[model samples]
Target: MRLVVCLKAVPASTEVAMDPVTHTIVRDGGDAVWNPYDTAALEVALRLKDEARAAGQEGWVGVVSMGIPATASLLEDALSRGADEALLLSDRAFAGSDTIATCYALTLGIGRLCAEPDLILCGKMAVDGDTAQIGPMLAAALRLPVVTGATTVERHGAAVDVEQVFDGARRRLCMHGPGVVTVDKDAATLRMPSIEGVLAARRTSVPVATAADLGADLDRCGLAGSPTQVVSCFVPERASDAVAIEGTPAEQAATLAYLMGEVLA
Candidate 1:
């Protein structure tokens, strides 16, 4: 079995700055880390790899990402976490890609990694965009089945059983191999990298794939391929001052209860 985990490097801090012209986040000059949710997906992928190894089955795990060349550092992080191989898709042509365009590029890159992958894992949403669209879009491009918001996954024969949190409830589902899943934070916590793993990753070579290498069309990549355009971005104006209620603890509770009842009722 072969698993491909897709990850993104996003700004580590909540303080994000936008480009005045493009209205996009200024990613190049920020301190970044692997998307928090992607870490959970990586954990799930590593666990599956371990399970396969314990069963004496031949399994390969690869980490794939599309970002600037500087973001290649995240590949080492992924490798230290247990990915057998890493591929970085980087090129100037791939810059300014929207969700749709990004997914299109990723699909091509994934195809280059393996003719057909047994499983693909991704974070439920990227902290940068918060769109939660790329995973499903990639699935569509690959013509593969997808399970979203997955909290847990178990391999069963030729199928994969997944548990997801939906509308405040847990739902279980079973799907065949060659599928994609967008994982939630509750999926699993990423394991810390040991010194040996870190050294191993440092020694490993990470292959870089360009847009041309992926056989991507110029008109179907980056800003040209993006359908949606950002018109403008601005901070909302502040609202009025808050209303303070002064009273004893019990009186305050009573007042809060009354306000809640009045508002809800």
Candidate 2:
């Protein structure tokens, strides 16, 4: 069984910057980490790989991400945690992409990974984008069935069965062969890298794919292809409504106590 996991490198800090001109996240460089939800998907892929090995069948997991050159570091991290292969889709042409354009680039690169993957997994949504649109869109692009918000997956020969969570209820679904699943963080716990695996990651050479390599239509990529436009990005103003008691320290304390008593009463 072959599994393709779409990984994403998101800003580690909440203090993400925005580009003034392009209106895109200014990822010029700060520490980056693999999206935790995507890590959950990888965990599922690893478990499936182990199961296939136990059954004396071939299992391979390939991890791919789309971002700047720094994204390779995240892929290497995946390698240290047991991903069989890694690929990075990075190109100047892929900048300022909205969810639709982003999915298009991913479809191109994943297509290059394998003509037909047995199973495709993605994080339910990226922390940076938080749109949760890529998985379904990519599935549609490839003409494959997809299950979103999947909490559990069980492969049955050529078919895969999945359980999805919604409004505190779980629903089971079975999809035909060659499908996609968007996994939530609750799906599985991620494993840490082993010492030996960390050492081996240094020697792994990850391939980089350009827009041309993905056969991307220049018009349908980057800011040019993105339909959604950000009119402006700014920090929201914080407002609070409260009364200030002005007096000597003791008097203020007494007034605050009286107010608290009134509220409690």
**Tens digit of per-residue lDDT, candidate 2, span 196-217:** 8888998998899999888899
In model 2, what lDDT does residue 74 have? 81
TM-score of each: 0.90, 0.88
- For residues 142-180, could you state the per-residue lDDT of candidate 1 as single tens digits? 889999999999987678899998899999999886999
Candidate 1 least-lDDT 10 residues: 21-30
Candidate achieving the largest lDDT: 2
lDDT of 2: 0.90
Q: Cα RMSD (Å) per model?
A: 2.9, 5.2
